[model samples]
Structures are given as structure tokens and as C-alpha cells.
Target: MVSRKEVAERAGVSVATVSYVLNGKPGVSEQTRQKVHAVMSELGYKPSYAARALKIKKTNHFAVLVHYLGDPFEAGILSHIEHQARRHGYFVSFQTYHPEDEERFLQEVSGRIDGVILLGQSLMPETLNGLRSAGIPVLSIMEPMQQSEWITTVDMDWEAGMTQLIRHLAEQGHRRIGFMATGIPRHPHEQRRQAFRSAMLAEGLPCEEEDVLSGGGRLEEAKSAMKHYLASEAARTCTAWIAANDLMAVGMLSACREAGLKVPGDLSIAGSENILMSEQTEPRITVLDYPRKHIAHIAVDMLVAIIENKQPRGCKMESRLLIRGSSMHE
Candidate 1:
């Protein structure tokens, strides 16, 4: 096997310099970093995980498992997690797995890192048990499940976020509001839907069962779903639409354009998670400004605390509603 010493000699740098470069430390200059990388490639050098695990007595690494990879909101959370992990002298690895393959991935994860950050709604009890037996602490970034004592959790107050959004719209005279969502309704952290329901009910606003569309994760899926919903009988009565996320709201806007509908003139749209893309669209989308950065920071801090054996208190963040051209009439 090509060793670090050999690479260090080939690069004409000290062994310590080679170590710093390979481990992604910041002290090495870009030029030196490039030279060290070249030496590693030429020598076919690969770091031995088992040897390092035994010598350093730590992996100095963590993993983040996400179920939904395409969602921008989820991506935002992940970016923040990675930043926090790097700051704590640990590298973050991301893995996407289906429910059927979760057990296998958990097995692989056990051998790879000291801890895990889950951006999932819930994990099967069996999977939780497997992780626990492996001595891998999990920090879940959504709603807390039955194993609150066994796992660390941090989540956005989605219910309050959406409640405030509805109240804002109601104050603006949006009486005939419509709610739309696309995707399976089984996610354990689906507080946005519940909040929308409660808000509409509290205002004595009518919520038609048909107005709540399902299966809306992808752009095309939401576009098709919204188009079909518009053709349905409910569209004749409802004038405003509240999407559970910004991506779906963008799709709704596209569907409206296809049907020759003008936003905020013929219909109004609102969504959750005020991502950057939301502002780029024409007549920017009104959405619940979820604290994506704050969410990532808190979740990571909790994970680090657990890894370091430090007791972390219950941490929480707030979500706000951002009014924009898509959902307001001025």
C-alpha cells in the first residue's frame, strides 16, 4: 500500500504537511494542496480507515441520511449541516436510501462514522433499534417520535408558521382560500398541512376536501396535479391557493399561466419555505420563511453535543411568513 510517508517524500513536503493536506485542513496553501493531491494520485495512496480508526481513536466524521434528495428545502438543511460539521473538525457524508434498503444502509453507516443526522420524518422502530445497538447516536431534524429519550431532535414550528400565513391572508380579505399539496401524506413531520387546516377552520373559512391536492413533490407532478384540480369543480369557487412548499407553488404558477390565469389577479398563491428560487420567479412567491440555516445549526449543535457526551437542552427556532406578489393584492 502507498503510505503517507512515500507521498510526502514524492511531494517534497514533510509528513505533517502531507497529513494536513489529505485531511482537508485549512493551513495548507492552495498551491501546496494541489501538489500534495498530485502526489497522492500518482502513488495511488488511499487512507486506511481501520488503521486510522484504531490510531486516532475516532472517526472524526459523521453522516447525514436524507429520504428526499430533490427537495430544495432539504438541500438547504443539508448544506448547513455540512458547514457545521466541518467547523467541528468532522466531515459530513450524505446518503440517500429507500425504506426497503434502510437496514442495509444503517449497517454500512455503523462502520463508517461516530454519529448520524437524520432529515427524515420518522424511522422504523426496528431501524432505530439497529442504530442503537450499533452505538450510533441519531439526531433527527424533524418531529420527535416515540424514542425521544433515545434520540436527539430539532424541528421547525411549522404549525405556527402556516397559522400566521393564513391569518395574514385572512386579514387581506382572502375568504375563499384553497390549500394544495402533492405527495404521500404519511410523512410524520407534515405539520404544514395540519396548520393550514387549523388556520382555515379557526377563521370560519370553508375548506373543501377536494381543494387539498396530493402528491406534489416534483415540478411536473405538481403542475399536472394543479391543472387537474383547476379543471375540477372546486376551482370555480376558490380564488387563492396555499401550497405546502415553494416548489409546488411555482408549479401552481406555471399551471395558472398555461390556463391563461394571471397571478394575484385571477388567482393567488402562497407556499412554505421562502427559498432563493422563490424570489427569482415572476411576481415572487409568498411563503413561510422557514429558518433553514438556523434549523441546520441547531440540529448539528445537538449532534455534536451528543457525540461529545455533553447534555444539550431543548433547542427551537422560529418560522415566519413572507408576503410577496404571488399571494397579495395591492
Candidate 2:
């Protein structure tokens, strides 16, 4: 309801000064900036995002594209991304797409915003080509996209995460370990699966192909896959299993119970994305603590730099292991 003009008048400063102070721009004296803040609080004047965006011809709004919002772990990361984007004078929008509905996604995103962030979705060659043609600067998180010389990207090092998990499992005397992953075409999980295979093979262990199960990356699908996996005799042979994400691991844990197996007592389970639910369970899940907040911050920081036409040193995020009762050996 209150306007910047009223705040400026009350602060005894020009409108331009108020603008600079409100936007956290440089060139305003700290003393005057404090005075402007006091006046703003007193006047209860809030800046209009629409006005700033219109004047600057920048949306200050970015869209995050994912497959779905079913996973609470991913939802938490999205919440962090939204908070970080807002702190930098930007807002975030989200869209969920089916991996098969490629045409719908392209139709929906064209010219809708200033930039886009792709998370955990398949990087089709055509989609990347289309984005390039449209001139929309895109940054991918969690997905390992093509390392094009021109496009900028920030991704979690899944190989590093899995290597840590594999080594930990090996140390616990888990020679014949199983693995579960989503069947989606994204690169991050695929890289983790490959890393698991490579790590196990290098350790003089023949990782059984039948031990790997596909969840299709959906929670219900993961549950079904895990159920089938547990029904098999091979499930009891492996002392441990590595899941691509905590969601599938949770499903696996449920399946283990339904099959009358004890966690870590009969079978050990490890997962990625150390979400909140992981720690609360009876036998807490051991997981890879991928830095979602850091990923969001780094992506936005890169987007801002690219938007301002500033040459930024692009970045890559790293992941680490967090041990818990789910995978610990007694």
C-alpha cells in the first residue's frame, strides 16, 4: 500500500537513493542506507517486484524443471533453491513433466521466463538444441548433461558419492552387494550406477547384474520393483544394497520388512540424498550427503553472472558420505 516516494521523502533522500538502497546496489552511503531502511520500516513501504523487473527488462524469475514433486527430499531442495533465488532479487517457478511428453514441455516453457534450471530430467539432444536456438541460458542440477564447450552447468559429483559408499560397504565385509536405481534417462543416477559397478569390479568383486533393480524413478514403481527384488532368492545373498536415492531406499526398507528380513542385521542398505526421513527411521539410513543448497546457490550465482553479462568462473558441486545404522556392521 505504501510507496517508495513516501519513504524517500521521509528519509530526506532522492527516489534514486531509495532504489539503490532497497536493491542492495552499491554507491549508497551506509549511513544514508540505514536511514532509508528506518524510513521504509516506519512507512511500511515494500518494493514492487513487477516494477523493478519492468524498469530493468529482467524477469528476476527463473523456472526449475523436474519430472515430478513426489519426493520430499527433492521438494526440500526446491524450497532451498527458492529461498536462495529470492535473496538474490529473483523468484523461482517450477514445472513437472513426464519424460515421454517431450512436446508438451517444449510448448510450455518457450518464452515463459528469463532462464531455466533442469533438475533430474533426461537431457535429450533435441531439447538442448532447442534451448540453444531459443537463446535461453540453462543450468542443469543433479543431471549430468553434455559437456558442451559453450553451455554452463553445475552438477553433483555422483561418481564421487558412489565411490565413497562402495568403499564404506566394502570395509563392512559387503562383497556381493546389490544396487537399486530409477530407470529414468538422467545422467546423475546413471553415473552413480556406473561408478558402483566400476568400484565393485576394481575391488576384485564380480558385481552380479541380476542384483541391480530399476524403479523407473517413481516412488510407487520403486516399491513394486523392490518388492519383486525381495521375492527373489538372490536378495538374501547380498549383505548390502546401494540405492540411487533415499526414496527408493525407503521403499527397499519396507520391502525388506514385508519379506521378514532385518535391516543391517540381515541386509544393509545405503542411499543418496540424505533427506530428513532417513535419520528418523528405526535403523537410520546411511546415505551420500549431496549439497542441494550449495547446488542451488551456485546455479543462481552463475545465472546472475550470465544475466549481467559478467564472465563467471563456472562451478561443480561435490557429494560426500554420511554413515548411519542402516549400513553399519555390528
- Please tell me which predicted candidate would have the highest lDDT against the true structure: 1
List lDDT for all candidates, in order: 0.74, 0.73
lDDT of 1 by residue, 1-330 (tens): 688899899999999998776544568877887787667656756454444335344677888878688778888889888998889888999986566876687768765787888786566655654554445677877652434455667867766777788788777777878777654655633566777888788778887787677745666788888899778775757778888778888888999989989998888888888878888888899988877888898888787776665656555567877899987753
Summed backbone clashes in each candidate are 5, 0
Q: Could you give the C-alpha RMSD of every candidate to the true structure, in order shown?
A: 15.1, 14.6
Off by over 4 Å in 1: 1-57, 144-149
Instruction: Give the per-residue lDDT of model 2 (tens digit) for 1-330.
Output: 678788889999999888787655679887897787667656745455345444455667777887467776667678878888899888788876555656666666655566777776555544544444344566766654554433567777766777788889888888888888776665357867887888777777768878788977655677788788777775577889888778888888878877888888788998888888777776889998977787778878887766665545556667788899898743
Question: Each model's TM-score?
Answer: 0.77, 0.74
Query: In model 1, which residue pairs have backbone atoms overlapping below 3 Å?
Result: 182-214, 182-215, 182-216, 183-215, 183-216
Task: Report residue 205 deviation for candidate 1 (angstroms).
Answer: 2.8
